[model samples]
Target: MSLSSFGFLIEEASRNVRRNGLMSAASITTVAVAMAVLGSAVFLLHRVQQFMDAQPRQFEIAAFVTMETSRSKAAQLKAKVQRIPGVYRVSLVPREAALRQMMDEDHKAGTRITDALVGANPLPDRLDVQLSDPKATRRVAAILRDKDKFPAIEHVRDDRETLDKLLATTRLIRNVGMAVALLLFLATAFVIQNTIRLTIFARRREIRVMQLVGASSGFIRMPLVIEGVFCGLAGSIIACGLVLLVIRQVSQFAGRLQTPFAFTMPAAMSPSVIVGLLLAAGAAMGWVSSTLSIRRYLRRV
Candidate 1:
């Protein structure tokens, strides 16, 4: 099509929106409301997944060295643990520091235990092993418990039960998130379908006149298609803004509500990528729903 034809199509689409003011507002508002609910759910899912993937919580392996193990032996063991397939790395905590920590705890408990053990630091050296994957902590801990392989290791300790519980909760969160997302998508689709149907009904005569003027089917359909896409885009933009606004407000209350189970409401995707995805989803939904609605009027056109 020529530039003038394209310009005319744009004008017609804009004119239709202005002429049917109530219908246009209703279409945009419905789409926006649906998108907003869906967008909020999407962000929440991302936050839950991030919490599952965060660090420190996954670092659960603790291996204590025997009293017979020398500092040099413990250092060598640290390097060997790092070479394990699933282990991230291990840090050696000297016995002296460990003793100090124990003493500090004793002091906090209103005890004079440190003075009694001044000549001998009875605490064993510690090797805190962090695994590449939290779920593999049990496997790694078992590997460390082999006395023949790691003679310096007296015992291996890990919060296996707690880690297991946390992982199970994460899985539950993921399953719930997926179910919520499906429901929200269906709701958005339903809203978009009705918006398109109502717009088509309001502009039935305009479509007929364009068809009578010997306009190509594509030409007559272009304006409504454009309108649908614009509506979707506008609704998504509003939805995204609302989602961000909600995040800001929630973050304020989040600070006080979460402790020991604290995690950030980080962006699910980069801002640009998220906006692009939302815009594309909105446009695609608008296009499909509008096409289906317009086909109802195509027989007469």
Candidate 2:
């Protein structure tokens, strides 16, 4: 089509929207509410996943060295553990240092119990291991415990049960969020589709007259598609504005809290990105829903 034809179609779309002012307002408002709810759910789930991903960095495993193993041998074990695939860092704590730490802890608790046993420190030297990934905790712990692999090591300790529980909870939350989002998407599409159908129904006679006058289907469809796109774009702007406002307020509140649970939005969900996503989703939903609505109606006419 020529530039003039495209311009004319856009004008027609605007005119249609103006002519049905009440329905257009209702459609835009409905789309905005639906998209807002869906977008908020997505934003929340993404943040929850980020928080879960961060928990692994603090997880640590302890590998105790036998009393017979010299400090030099424990250093060698540290080197070996450091070479493991998921190992982030390894530090060998000497038996003397471990005993001193225990004594300090006892003293802090208002007791002198551990002071007398200073010379008879029975605490074994241990390697404190930090992991790059929490999921690898079990495998690394198993490797540390292998007698043949490191005979100097007496035993390994890790909180596998806690890690498993954390993973299970994350998966459950993600699955449930996805299911809810899908349902919201279907409902939003239905509303947009029906709204567009109402507009088309009001203009049925005009469409038939154009068809009889030898206007191509493309000519008849272009204006209606443009109408949907406009509505979608308008609705998206409103939804994005509301979501951004809530995000800003929540982020500020989280930052002021003096706790480990304080949350800031992840870098991936920047304001610019959020706006782009909502606008794109709204426009695509509008285009597809409107096209489907009109195609079915045209078949009978």
Candidate 3:
């Protein structure tokens, strides 16, 4: 199309939006609401994934040695485990350190359980191993459990079941979020299509007149398509703004409630890319709705 033709299409679209002010507003609002929900879901899924990713690395696998094991043998066992594949760090937690940790916890809980009261420190000296991969915990544990490999080692303790449950929950949430977002997106599209159809219905007479005067189908369709694009663009912008506001408000509310979870909004992208996506989505939705609406009317016309 020529520049003048494009200009005419834009001008006609603006006029249509203004003439059907209520319908335009409804379409924009629907688009905005739908986009906002989808954006929020996307942001939440990303944040949850980050949290889950951090969990496994933080998990500590404790390799407890036999109570009668010699200090030299314990050090040798620690060195051997440290050399194993996937072992990120290996530190020996002496019996005294284990006792100290328990004492600290008891003190924090306002309990005074002295060593004399407990008869003796029953805590075992352990090799505290941090893995580079949380998913390798089981394999790492198995390696540590080999009596021939680490004869001094008595048991291996890790929160394997809890970590598995957490990962499973994360996957479930991701799947559910995607399913809901897709359903909402389709619903939004349908609503916008119907809204555009209503606008086209109101202009059916004008379209018929143009067609009778030998106006090309392209010429007749261009303005409505542009109008749809405008609606989508406007809706996306409004939705983005609303989502930002909601995130800010939620963060503030969480702080007041002393909630452990904090909202982390996505970083702003380059203005050009951000604008492009929003406008493109809006325009595409608008075009699709307009095309369908016009096609149905054209059959009767």
Candidate 4:
């Protein structure tokens, strides 16, 4: 389209919005709220997936070593475990550290178990093996348990139940996120479409006159489409600002949490990417709703 035509459409679109102040505001608010809800759900799903990713470590294999095992021998043993097909990480859990952890737990429970065992530390040092895939946990465990497979590996232990629970929770989050997002997307489209219909209806007389003068459908509909797009874009911009504010507040509040967390919270999407998505959603809602609403109106004419 020529610059003059573009400018005319923009001017007309802006005038339509200003003329119907309340309806325009309502449409913008509705779109903003729907987008915000969907965006929040997506953000939460990302965080949930991060936790789900860390869950496999909880079901990792514990390979105990003989009391006579040396530091060099343990290092060699860890290196050997890393060479295994599915093993991605093999961390050494020294006996002293293990004892300290146990004692710390006991103290929290109001027990002085460490004092009773002060003369000798009988806890065994171990190697913790993390698998690239939790499904390989049993296979890796069985391999470690083979007869005389690294004599220092006294035993190999893994818990399948923990892995199962973690997997279930992740799946639940994914299903719920998708359902909520779809519902919100549809609601946003409806709000934009309804808003555009009202804008067009108010100009029905002008449209009939244009038709009588041999104006093409595109000539009459372009301005209405622009109005719908403006509403969508405005709502999307406001929604993005709100989402960013909410995320900042949430991050600050989370940082002040009194209870300790075992794992770090996963990083959020980059600011640029998030802003781009919000803008795209807004523009898409505007364009799609305007086109659909105009086509529906044109059919009746």
Per-candidate local distance difference test: 0.77, 0.83, 0.77, 0.82
lDDT by residue for model 3 (1-301), tens: 8999889888888988999999889888988998888766765666567767676556768899999998888998889899999889999989998888778766865778764556587877899898998878999999999998888889999878877886799889998998988887787777767766776787788788888898888988888877777888889898778666666665566446532122233343344554465557666876787688667655434
Candidate 1: regions farther than 4 A off: 53-57, 66-68, 83-85, 95-124, 133-135, 146-155, 249-268
Worst 10 residues of 2 by lDDT: 259-268
Q: For candidate 4, what is the lDDT?
A: 0.82
TM-score of every candidate: 0.77, 0.73, 0.72, 0.82
- Tens-digit lDDT string for candidate 2 (12-91): 89988999898889889988887887787787778768867766665678899999998888888789889999999999
* Model 2 lDDT, full chain set: 0.83
What C-alpha lDDT, on a 0 to 100 scale, does residue 225 get in candidate 2? Answer: 87
* lDDT of candidate 1 over 1-301, digit per residue (tens): 8999999999988987787777778778777877776776676667667767774444458899999988998999999998887788789999999888778767866889788976798789999887878767878888899888888899888877876677688779778878877887776666666666776777778777877988788997888888888788888888878877766665667655633322454445665666677778889988887787677645564
**Pairs clashing within candidate 4:** none
Better of 1 and 3 by TM-score: 1
Per-residue lDDT of 41 in model 2:
73
Which scores higher on TM-score, 3 or 4? 4
- Which prediction has more favorable lDDT, 1 or 2? 2
Please give the RMSD to the true structure for each candidate, in Å.
4.8, 6.0, 5.5, 3.8
TM-score: which is higher, 1 or 4?
Answer: 4
